[model samples]
Target: MGLRGRWYRGGTSKCWLFDSKDVALHAPTREEIPALLSAAFGAADARQLDGVGGGTSTTSKAAVIWATPDADADLDYLFAQVGIGDPTVELGSNCGNCATAIALFAVQTGIVAAEDGMTKVRMRHITSGAVLSGTVPTPGGHIPKSGLARVPGSNAAGVPVNLSFHGPWGQNTGALLPTGNAVDQLQVNGRTLRATMVDAGAPAVLIPAEEAGVDLSSMADNLSGSLPTLIAARASAGLAMGLRNPEDPPQNAVPKVGVVAPAGDYIAADGTTISADSHDVRVRMLSMLAPHPAIGLTSAVAVALAASVQSSVVADAAGQAPLPGTGAPRMLRVGTPAGVIITEIISDEKGMVSEVALHRAARHIATADIDVAQAAELSA
Candidate 1:
């Protein structure tokens, strides 16, 4: 009768759910889906007065699913990153947080059989066609509702979600260095910037914190209200890094920016105190065209990738984490606006990262049925 779905907050993201059998997507056009997505997740207001966006890009998302089409993969998941402050939905991107939600969703829906300790799930992303192998903590052969691992934010400890992606270097485009160079020198707004451009979980621009005139050594509290400048810098950096039209780019898009400086102390937006002595580098990231008070899981991985590779721009920024060999996962601890996120990326002998893993604790708020009238209309 209507679009039946559930809602759950995974890490820093929230998603609207749908079962594929109940709804057949027939390659629907944008006009058919954009309006429904906008209404469900707000596009005009910062607070998303219309629905549940929470005024943050990472929090606004939609997930369309179906039974596994491949016998090898456990479930089929289509993740759409809905722009929080805009009316556009990019179906070509994957959300690490949402991906985590999908695994739990599969287990909850019984689409995936819970295993003893770790439940391995093979997920085929509808957008990039990349396959990701995810392992979750499933105690008693059931998805555990609690765990000892704690993520930087959300303050909720539940099951742990670890995902490793294969062939992610060229996720959207066709090369690790989208422009055929790890570092590119570009001019933006009359400023010269040397950048490392790479495609991992998503597209991103890695910038030296000092070059951007951002003193990462000081606490973020000392740089209060400077987010606008940082955002402008990130936008400029994104443009130089060969992003598709850095100005007025896709709403809530990737190729996020990361500014790094030598380690130092800082206060998080959540009021949590952090000392830089405990971290290798002081990092700040922007999500969806704006500087987020916290960092996204995928963004962190991209930073780790940049850090691993030695370049003119990132040469001195990264610590002494050995480059991973084939089938070996790189352990990366990124200091973000919130606190820290540990990223593990598996790479082959040729320095190609096969998969990425992010382990964090989150709360299982609630899952329920609701009617999405517009989504139903689009299907028709």
Candidate 2:
């Protein structure tokens, strides 16, 4: 039998969306899920030439949505990171970019009724128990394709979809400071480097690019040489964050690694110049061991949280710019290789991170069916 799926461009990332019912029909047991996803994505091949995967980590994601019993949430969204060069699928984390597209999928698939103007869809991530609210513009019961919101890596303009991650701290590792310290001296490759491991929207290890002997402005230029060090640092930090153990092989998706530095002149992926004065901090986050073309939404949230802390590496890289007035939310502009992404961070009376919000755009790309037999044969 064929499984129904939809392709969506959510922010800078793309993913394949499937109804939970359809997924259950295909893979009845959890053990079979990885094989099923690998077959569908044409894994075990670096290029992913036989499947829909775009041959990159950012495009090799999948999401399954289903109705939930909780009254606060309209549906449950499960995100899966499908491997391209290996036959592995990691469901330990959530994809903030794909989370924004779930709202549109719910409305288009009749899981939720869409009203005129903007519709708010509540989602619960099954893996981390994190709740996110996605506000999508639905004019006349149809998602509008045009709007003012523009993401850094995408070429098209669309309505700004506002996503608010509620209670985002400790979504995966169970503690905001998973290592119990704002900063830790990590021993990597015979040298100790200052690192901050924070769990906000996601668990991320932030390290200074200079400490690693890499140029932040030209991260992509040295990605091949720097990945080994970054991956080693990530694995070590993952163990400290309690996301991995010495007995278990490192899962490259979780506890993302970000190399940070003060804003500087850099060349964007589009060949445009990003002025140092335009952005507060420069960052390059990795997805599945490769430098992401753009920053992930959840990573941006983690960066905002890390930057607010006084002694963290991200804060030091951001310099002494004052955050917004205490009572209101503040927008922090983050510079990535693609461009600048604006993230809003709010703090409580106790000065702890209260909420993080950002704007993303989603577009309905295509609706299709996957032949399970064909996928399985390709894997074989």
Candidate 3:
């Protein structure tokens, strides 16, 4: 079986997208979705040399998208993390990056008509129930595919898609602080680590680098020396935050786990020097099992919102300071390996995050009919 798919460069990742209708008609039941998608992406092979999977967590992703009739939301985005070398898919988390991609794709496919100036597409994540509004610049009422906006991570030129998450607090776990504490003591790797478990954009655990006992100074070192520890921490944190059961397998996605450090000068992946004064917090996160080149957009939202809560690990380390005169409703500069991603988080009188804005870029690469073999045939 094959399905019509569109390839898109969203934020810092590449994703293949399909219509929910086609997926419902073509794909099998929920239990067999992993197998079906795996065969399609050639995930059974680690390299994915025979299929479209990019052999990495950031690239080996697909989503089922559709328009919704709900007055509040114009589109629905269901994100899927297609496994790498494993025949499985994770549907438990929301992806701000993919949501950005789907917003532009909606304009391209006429799901939402393009307005003369900046068009707004209200997107709701079916996975985690997070609501996001994306602003797609449609100059002259034309499709905004060709763009000049640039973010920290990718070099690809794409339409500037600004995503604003509305009322994202309690999105995944029904509360801003999932553990009901600004700081929690978590046990992992036979050591006690202090962490802040937040659930604004998604369920996330932010651990200080000192407690995690890993050096987040270098990107390469963060990947090689810190992956195992972070993975273990993710498993332990997930269990502690009630995101996982004692019997279920470890989740590869949420709760988004990351290691945080003070705003320190570091060399970026592109060999550029990032000054400490330029950003608030330095963060290194795991995409799946490896260090993400840049933090995920949802995770960035989590960090930014988490910083708003006093005594949270993110707040302790981030300091919530950006350069002078760089104003939004409120903002924080997150220093990633790629460079800096500024996250704008707005708070209500109650100090809960009411809205968040993340800058991203997306470009539709191509549209094609993807051929997919039976999972059983491939496994055999």
Cα misplacement distance, residue 321 of candidate 3 (Å): 9.5
Supply every candidate's count of residue pairs whose N, Cα or C atoms clash at under 3 angstroms.
8, 0, 0
Indicate whether candidate 1 or candidate 3 has the larger TM-score: 3
lDDT of 1 by residue, 1-380 (tens): 24456676677776776676544442254345555556566554457665555676667777777667457677777777776656677775577777777777777777788888888777877766767766777878966665665567666666677766656667667666677776776564577767777776777777787776766644344344555555555566455445557456533365666677766676666666677666766677766665666676667666666666666255356554447566766666667777866777677797766666777544456554434435434334
Q: What is the lDDT of residue 269 in candidate 2?
A: 73
Per-candidate TM-scores read 0.84, 0.94, 0.95
Q: Which ten residues in a row have the lowest lDDT in candidate 1?
A: 370-379
How do these models rank on TM-score, best leading? 3, 2, 1
The residue ranges of model 2 lying beyond 4 angstroms of the native Cα positions read 140-142, 145-148, 219-222, 320-325, 374-376
| Candidate 1 overall lDDT versus native | 0.65
Where model 3 places Cα greater than 4 Å from the true spot, the runs are 28-32, 321-328
Choose 1 or 2, whichever is better by lDDT: 2
